[model samples]
Target: MSPLPGIVGALLVLGGCMVGLRLLQRRYHPHPELVRKLMHLCVGATALSFPLLFHDPQPVWWICGVAIAFMLALKYVSPLRALLGGVLDSVDRFSLGDVYFLAGVAVLFTVSGGGLTFTIPMLVLTFADALAALIGVGYGRLRYPAADGVKSLEGSVAFLTVAFVSAHVPLLLSGATGRAESLVIALLIGILVMLLEAISWQGLDNLFIPLGTFVVLNGHLDRPLELLLFHLAAAVTLTALVLLLRRRLGLEGSALLGAAFVAYLCLTLGGWPWLFAPAALLAGYALLAHRSRLPGDIHALVALTSPGLFWLLLAVYGRRPELYYPFTLSFAAQLACAAALALPADPDGRVRPGPLAARVGLAWALVFVPYAVLLGAGGLVPALHGLCVTAVAALLCLALRRARRLSFELQTTLAATASLFGLAPLGA
Candidate 1:
């Protein structure tokens, strides 16, 4: 009838599930997977039903708070660990799956206040990912390696297919007769979510998949065709790069896919003139990998850092030339320099500073030369500022190469980010 009663009822439901899990642990002992999935199903179902059942967010927030607290207690307090028994036996010792699960639900619950943003992504995770797990475990034959372990190609296909259908079918049926935009958004979101899961370190896909889906819906739903074309370009670039990488190393399919995705985003999303750097880096690495005969692995720090800067730019300034220019240009220079330093010179992963400068110079010329012509001499100061900042970042990366807390990856990320701020004045 009121918020108080609704809170009570929701808590009771949560407590009931906990007690049920505890009883299952005692009775079944080793059937922890069943208990785990049962909890997952109940949690998701409860969250999805919240906005429908209650009229306000107070009860929903309160329930999520309790769930979060319970998960934290289970993790830190020794006795609570017995609740899940062995369902998490295969997970890493430091795995945050439980916490992330509750967090995902809480986030989606809040997003549900706005409508389909929550409903579609939750269904995709609860239905698609789960189906993929079931199918992959029993029938999956063609497999690839992951941070957690090997996953089946068939299983991933299942995930993508289910996610696609769950995410888009409602749009088509929801009286959007003249507009195909929603379908495009669904495809972009589904593929991105699927790839993000494939490369998710440890088990963090729980967080990324849900959150990423929300971003696509919130940011690009109105511009579905543009988003679709952007992602398609990403797919095309990623595919072409994979073919080139094949001639060099026996890299995993996911790695190739992620690289392509990153390459395309870096090259396509920002300013047209600024993209040449990512393209050059992609070409250089593809060639180097082939020539050097070394195995290629997509480092998370590098992969995340490259795209992350782009996201930061978009989030902060979108496509505004004045602000976006400095950030994008500095990012390009940082990566170009880093690529020079990090490029495969030999089998030992050593840097050839002389060659590094040459490569960086070439990449810079390809990017800024065209930029300067288009914008006239006005682009000169910003271009110089960007180069100086990147050179400085290159040195920082070298100095911090052995820092225990700041890995080369972390240093580059920080340096690249800082360069944007440092050079923003020039663009402004």
Candidate 2:
């Protein structure tokens, strides 16, 4: 089929699906999510046909653009709202899920040119997610916090089971991989995507799940079975370890899962030596949090670790060896700054600068010494450079500490900025 007819047909199918769902909703008045998931399944299933119907990506883009405009019209345009709003707007929570769904589908189709790589993510999104939601709403009893709302262990398990099937059946049917390799790949994708969904806020899951699935699948598609098994083991082991320390860490369930995802990314992409700083920070913070009852959540974790995550990406993805030290130092500075704040305050609830400075020095030494040793082993010596950077971070953190209102944010920013020290020509 040519692009024009394909675009028209695609739009017609999407419109028909929406209008059909609206009629069912008006007549039957089923649960909003049931109707929503029905729409999700229909649209996703229709999307699977794009690889065949249109040979080029232009038509897919056109279809997605039109659909997004129509979806927005349903939300805001009064006439369209009266006609089409019943199906989508029935839910109470705020969501741009429909919009994100269209966008993700378009991007995935374009990038993978619509093949097995595209098929699995779409299936996971279309089937696994829809089933998980319906099952979660009906049968889920063991609940915990997720993004803006709560999710059930039952729901997550459902998602994992369906995602595994979605990933496995395709690989097995295509005969692209052996059974053992297929099994390992499916398990890894299931665990990772489930965690992605668990931590997604708003309608971003529609965006993240497919893209994340593509990354995991494409990155490991050709690896040996041994590496695949190792990856699978690492994901499971990290998840288990985090859950075991959930209480001591003082992070919510979703936050803990987020931590596991970040840790896995670091370990797999950056290697064992790269894992030290974050692990040390987490361990020390977990100890202090348990002692002082300090609570940290997903938002806090993002704030503190985003910079280090950036540096890690640069070192690995951009092939910049110099940035590795910056990546490691960012975490060290983060730990040092955090530790300084954990000091015992005076009876009046004020922290003296002398004790604060002493605390910062002690904390930096504790975190950096081990990390520096690892860097030396890895053939990068930034020891003196790291010390100077950390001292500057501690001083800036001390200066920002008196701000009282924005202390944590200020200190975190300062610590991240210390990464500049690592940018100084490596050997110099």
Candidate 3:
């Protein structure tokens, strides 16, 4: 298989996409969404053909770089922006979807461990997501705006259905998913993807659907019943928390999901015996949230999402508890700092970065030092990981204050990305 053919195919698709989008823009000036979806469909379809086009990973990288470069070019280049209405004309201040799309594609090519992993993310994105966009607008009714989006129950269910079938079909054909595996794991992945999609706004689904689907598929729940029960319990309890706190705290549905998922993942990975620290700590925070009147800001989000993400990654990938708990404790300390920073300081309600750092240092000393001492050297990497997360989250909040609004959800989510270990692994 000559690589030249695949490379040529990719180039042609890229050129055609630019030209086609221009044609569409001239013809359908008012239909920005149509133009956008068309772009999504074309790019996704092109990504789907990668395996057929390139026998090796090198060309995939070349294609990815070229595509990303082109997207970036579109952003800065005036004529190109005019031609495509700047990547689908979403309300987001920036084209996050373009970055997400390319990242998802690159992730699939680089990280997929063959078999089901290679195909599932691509299939759902290429087919299920595209289908959902079309079906959601056409057939959707009984809309819920805040919890999900302008999405209706019918459309959400439609996405789940297609996602589930898309997941099962390729694996079934390739003999990667057996009957039992398909019954539970595949179904769960589909449902999870749908839940994420429901919460997704501004085509963030381009990122979450593919990457999240990949993670869930890779987690490989061996004792499905146990995790299922745990997930259910956590989801229910956290949702109840959302109901209780939403009006007062201004928490979003995604925040509720963050609480729920970490509750499950934390307890599951740590097992029944290891639930004490998180349980006690969170309960204490609940009180602080009440008495302190914590603002539902991005700082609070960073507080929750840290533990949530670390627990999730730790459970999924951290096979050994000895080494990971230190990292977990470090994040715990950071969470405490995040919680404190969520409140106003001194007589004034303003938060200063200097005092915030001092408080964070104190919190880390109070929590991480003791926990790390208890755990010994096993906690080193986890502690470093946790410290770095807190530092970066704080710095980013400080740095981008003028540019981006520091919402709780985005802050917490940014912290959570740290927990994902940068899409690598939990390591030394």
Number of the predicted model whose lDDT against the real structure is largest: 2
Which residue pairs clash within candidate 3?
A: 298-408, 301-412, 327-382
Q: What is candidate 1's lDDT per residue for 309-340, written digit by digit as tens?
A: 55445644654545545544544554554555
Over 4 Å off, model 3 = 85-87, 90-93, 133-156, 198-204, 221-250, 273-288, 291-299, 311-320, 323-428
Model 2 Cα lDDT, one tens digit per residue, 1-428? 35787788888888899989999998989999999989989889989999888777788888889989988999999998998897877887889988999999999998888899999999999999899999999999999887688889999999999999999999999987899999999999999999998888778889988999999999989999999998999999999888887787777767888888988998899888777777767786775423533245666778778898998898888887567778877877877666666766565546677776665665566666776676565533576667767777865665565555445677778888887677773742
Worst 10 residues of 2 by lDDT: 287-296
Candidate 1: lDDT of 236?
Answer: 50
Pairs clashing in candidate 2? none
- In Å, residue 246's CA in model 3 sits off its true spot by 4.8
Q: What lDDT, from 0 to 1, does candidate 3 have? A: 0.61
In order of TM-score, best first, we have 2, 1, 3
Span of ten consecutive residues with least summed lDDT in model 1? 287-296
**Higher TM-score: candidate 1 or 2?**
2
lDDT, model 1, position 369: 63
Candidate 2 CA-lDDT value: 0.82
- Model 3 CA lDDT for position 387: 63
